[model samples]
Target: MSDDCIFCKIIAGQIPAKIEYQDDDILVFHDITPQAPLHLLIIPKKHITNLNEIRTENADIISKIFTQIPKLAFQFEISEKGYRVVNNCGKDGGQTVFHLHFHMLGGRHLEWPPG
Candidate 1:
């Protein structure tokens, strides 16, 4: 994990967060700065800078993350209406956090081609 990564601190319990789900491989929690009515972040425990850095060995772990999204959505009661999952890759993509994470947005209608 990166020494200064906020997410790593959250995972290590060095910082506090409103966690929704967690397991051996991942952790799901509410965004401290929510962009939507139901904005949450799903992140892998192992620190990877971004999607571009994901290795072949992490393929299964990546699949596991996607597999868990639906279940997490259900737990948050947003499965019926729908939700948007986003991964910001780099600086140009608006990635503020260095650690890779997926943003799950729902609980209301969302416009396409997000700004």
Candidate 2:
């Protein structure tokens, strides 16, 4: 884990967050700045920088994260309504943090071609 990674800090329990769920592989927490009514971040325990950095060996780990999103949304009461899972890749992709993570947004109608 990178020493400067915020998600790493959150997973390590160094930086506090409104934790929603956690397991051996990932940590789910409420976004400090909510976009939708249910704006949560699904973070991998193993740091992978960003989408551009994802390697073939990381496929299983990434798949596991995708598999957990549905359950996590349901757990947070956003399943029946629906949700959007997003990952900003790089600077052009609007990725502020370098860590690989997915945003689960729901509880409202997300506009087409979100920014």
Task: Give all TM-scores, in the order shown.
Answer: 0.95, 0.94
- Backbone collision tally, model 2: 0
* Per-residue lDDT of model 1, residues 11-110, tens digit only: 9999999998899999989999888999989999999889998888886668988999999889879999999999999999999999989999999999
What global local distance difference test value does model 2 have? Answer: 0.89
Best by TM-score: 1
User: What tens digits encode model 2's per-residue C-alpha lDDT throughout 6-91?
Assistant: 99999998999999888898888999999988899998899988877778988777888899898887787888878999999998
- Candidates in order have lDDT scores of 0.91, 0.89
Clashing pairs in 2: none
Candidate 2 vs. truth: CA RMSD? 1.1
